[model samples]
Target: MLQNEQEYIRILRSRLEGTMPHEELDDYLSDYREHFRIGKANGKTDGELWQSLGSPDNVAREIRVTHLVKKAEGNRSARNIFHAAFATLGLGLFNLVFVLVPFILLVVMLLMIFIVGVLFAIIGPVAFVFSLLQGGLPAFSSWISPLIGFFFCTGMTTFGLLMVIGDYYLARFFYHVGIQYLKWNISVITGTECSA
Candidate 1:
């Protein structure tokens, strides 16, 4: 049989009950309930209201994804972030290129910069030591003057450290922007009349 308002609410509650807190879930469901009530008042049947809202399952999935992403942003854990990204990726095929590929590239680039930063930070001291020991250890000697080597190493160290710091802020900025984008995508691209 085609679902009615109660059935629709039951399905949504079943899907979201365990994953989200009660208050939040209630707040979320209230929007749908209001939709149904308004539709009925306007002389629409339950089936029509349900159809306009789209599939209950799709609505639940969108809510789940949004909640998970919000949770990840609040707590900031790797697992949470991965789950959010993965959920976002599951939204559609377009996300494979627009979301997944960019996310992967961003993670790789951040890690590379962080590793390079740490390497240069460590190498700077080692190189300074090498320049100092050049007279005794020919192999350790730098081709440039010790003074020039000192400045170069110092600059590299500073630049690398700055890169890492900048990358961290960039990650945070992207995280916020990503959440906004996901919210928009879920609302606009989900093939449903989303509740405001």
Candidate 2:
């Protein structure tokens, strides 16, 4: 039996706290008032009609919750896309670093290893000549020196490959973890229930 439309809008605004669209709030209040009038014609009091529609607080809470859930879902989609793009960027950067720097480093390291191996090969012959002249136990063990150089070069090559693979996998794992953390935080913050 509310006579004034403005009074009804004021009550709804106080309850909704500016969360719902103003036009929608106006429509909903108009509908509720019409329904209340119908209930009044059917012998219900204003209090009875209000109670049947639900507590104003509960109605407001439901509207707020629905709006927030939709907003959260929209935000979640945006964040997912953003995180995916960022992760792709991170992976791209990781690939660029590993491919360019490691490729260059591997080439330099191999060149250095080749130079050292050649020096060792030359040293073996030089030591052999010196040993023959000095009559000392072959200054460099002829068989052992080449074997040591070969194994050292092989180990360095293996280690360089492993480091590149490890870098790729580590970057992938951290990017996935970071995306999951962002998703979890968004859900927690946006899923909070509004008080009635």
Candidate 3:
């Protein structure tokens, strides 16, 4: 049916009711309400306004994806990010290569960095102990100085810790960027750029 402002608002509210909080739902609906109000004030009919706004279902989907991305950003969970990415991927075929490939590569890169950091963290202590033993054994001490080995082990441990910390920040940065890109993608894909 989707002929008038009330019907448009009702459909959006019903479709998004369970997925979004009441306050947030009201906030989004208000935008449409304003669009309708302004259009009517300018002498446009309800049908014309509704048509220009596009389908309520499509609008609902865009809002849903945007909300999911925001939720993932706030909570920072694997499940949340997966849901957000999956939802965005559903928007268009281009996302299959653009979104999915980059996501996979970034995840693999982060995991590899984490594993390397853990290996270094473990090996650093063992190396430190071995270096101390070298001082006690004159033959081993001739091969490498205990003091030099101690510094090297310390440097490895410090670098590993920094790598782990840096990875965390980098993940957060990418997550933020991903969310913004998804928002833009949804806007463009759905032809709701003005509303977005």
Candidate 4:
């Protein structure tokens, strides 16, 4: 179906209006209007400009991803990044393999490490108490001296804290890297332009 200038703007507005701030939405619309005005001045029709820019839906999808990615970067929140990643996935089916699978694996790995860190942090104090009590934990009290156990528990707690801290830094690193990758993917790997 052929789209006129009005149809193109309408489609973009419909898809993206609620998802971003009004100023941003107006900026996008203004840019498209400029493109149309320039094209028309050069003796090109609305259809030609629309075709060059690609279908409004695909273009809107790109805009949404860009908006969400910027939000993620600005806020550094997991929810924002997650929304951006999923929006990137919407650009094409190949992203199911290229983006989603790796994202899931990375998230699971991070979560596992976090859980292990928390378990160690909790167990250290529990084991410390057992090691000190009269009827302490059977295995630890039987073989370990109280002073040694105290040191061991302290070491365990410290290691856990370090792990937790490391995990946080690692997550930040991944988040930064992921945002860059998503920017590249949306521009180079996904449909930066489309036809209608």
The candidate maximizing TM-score is 4
In model 2, where do residues sit more than 4 Å from their true spots?
1-9, 74-196
Q: Which ten residues in a row have the lowest lDDT in candidate 2?
A: 187-196
lDDT at 41, model 2: 88
What is the alpha-carbon lDDT of model 4 when measured against the actual structure? 0.80
For residues 1-196, what per-residue lDDT tens digits would candidate 2 score against the true structure?
5534344445666765555467876777777778877878898877666666676656665655566555545677765444334333443464466345755675565456556555555555555445455454253444445445445545555555555555556556756765565455334333332332
Question: 37, model 3: CA deviation in Å?
Answer: 27
> How many residue pairs clash per model?
0, 0, 0, 0
CA lDDT of each candidate?
0.77, 0.55, 0.79, 0.80
Residue-wise C-alpha lDDT for candidate 3, range 1-196, written one tens digit per residue: 6499899999998777756577998999999999999999999999988888889988898898898889879999876676677677675566877778899999999989988987887777777886676662243455677776777778888888888888899899999988888776654443233243
TM-score of each: 0.49, 0.33, 0.50, 0.55
- Residue 166 C-alpha lDDT in model 1: 81
Tell me which of candidates 1 and 2 scores higher on lDDT: 1
Instruction: Tell me the RMSD of model 4 versus the true structure.
Output: 12.5
- Candidate 2 Cα lDDT to native: 0.55
Output the number of the lDDT-best candidate.
4
Candidate 3 or 1, higher lDDT: 3
* Residue range 74-106, candidate 1, lDDT tens digits: 989876676677666675676777778978888
- Encode model 4's per-residue lDDT on 123-169: one tens digit a residue: 88888887678544456546656777778888888888888989999
